[model samples]
Target: MQTHELIKALAADSRRTGVAMNTVWWGAVLVAIVVATTIFFALLGPRPDIAIAAQTVRFLFKFVVTIALAASAFALLRMLSRPETDPRGLLPYLVIAPALILTGVAIELIAAPAETWSSRLIGTNSLVCLTFIPLIGIGPLALLLLALRHGAPSHPALAGAIAGLAAGGIAATFYASHCTDDSPLFVATWYTIAITILALFGALGGRVAARW
Candidate 1:
């Protein structure tokens, strides 16, 4: 068969099976990572030390969540590649949470003054509002992606809200590992704000992506 025919055949198979290439690829990656991690943990057995156990669990959690985020990012990219449809409609919200939270952290790192950055690196009690402020944009950007894709304005707000929540949760997981504050007040304050932006991104994007 000709190359064009093969391409057509593959596209048809993909649509018929309702499986996107990135989805399958990332799914396999996730499965492999999970299997490897499981095997490693099993081989190692349980550590008697509490700190070891805690660290092991934390690493596992991070690995799993990272896989999830990768899968979600693939889904979003798949949606972007296709024409606007229900499945595509869902991708922005699926991927936005992790994207935004990471972005917020990046912003935090960028905005910190040299001394403050050094202090925070050393686990000081310094607070940087600048770091937290840019995270607020993550959710909005998620919504923007949806809007740009859909070209309508119906459900961006709701989408943004959900995206924010997802982003915040993912962000908190990493923060939980590194953050020394360990205080409900700190999490409730900063993490809450970060996720709130994710939600807004969904809401704003919902309508934008709806354009048919």
Candidate 2:
């Protein structure tokens, strides 16, 4: 075939594939994540005191921060899904949410009593936070990795890691409702650890699953 015809054919193929991937495949994966998460939350239920305005607000704050991080990381993941796309421009922005939360943590510490700080930091639900966040995150992480397969990612592990961040963020958002600990210290410590663990899992999974 002539060069012009070959180019046209490839372009048409790319467009068709893009549409299918974006519409059908991506939508299915998103719905799966939502359904799975909703089921998990229904079975587990939010903390009993969640109706209390003060407690609910605290949980909501944590959820907002986590979702923000997930949103930014997911955006980056989408960009990285395409080969040769550099995420440098948007990468730095990922820290904004965490930085703001950490600042709040610092202020909280300064305001609280010295001895109480340790208890707040160590929160009663540390173990639960660690366990549930990753547990809930597994499905989303898998789905994100599956989505990444639709594109050509140059650095599979890195892409996977970002997907993990997105998954972790999402998991943390759901876990927040069940978590009783409202202090920023608790969130900064345990939530961060849980999210990081998922990110590591993503890295490992990416090495195997995301390989082009």
Those runs of model 1 whose alpha carbons end farther than 4 Å from true positions after fitting are 1-17, 21-156
Q: How much lDDT does each candidate structure score? A: 0.42, 0.79
Model 1 — which ten-residue stretch has the worst lDDT? 125-134
Write one digit per residue (lDDT tens) for candidate 1, span 1-212: 97556545645555665544444534433443344344334433233453553555333443344335434643443443333234445755565445544554455567656566544443332243224322423433343344334222223444334434434344434334444432232333554555455555545554455333
Model 2 accuracy (lDDT, Cα): 0.79
Model 2 agreement with the true structure over 66-147: per-residue lDDT tens digits: 8888888887887676665666766685786688688778888788998999999998999989888888888888888888
Candidate 2 residue runs with Cα over 4 Å from true position? 1-17, 24-29, 53-57
Q: How good is model 1 by TM-score?
A: 0.37
lDDT of 1: 0.42
Task: Find the candidate with the highest TM-score and give its number.
Answer: 2
Clashing pairs in 2: none
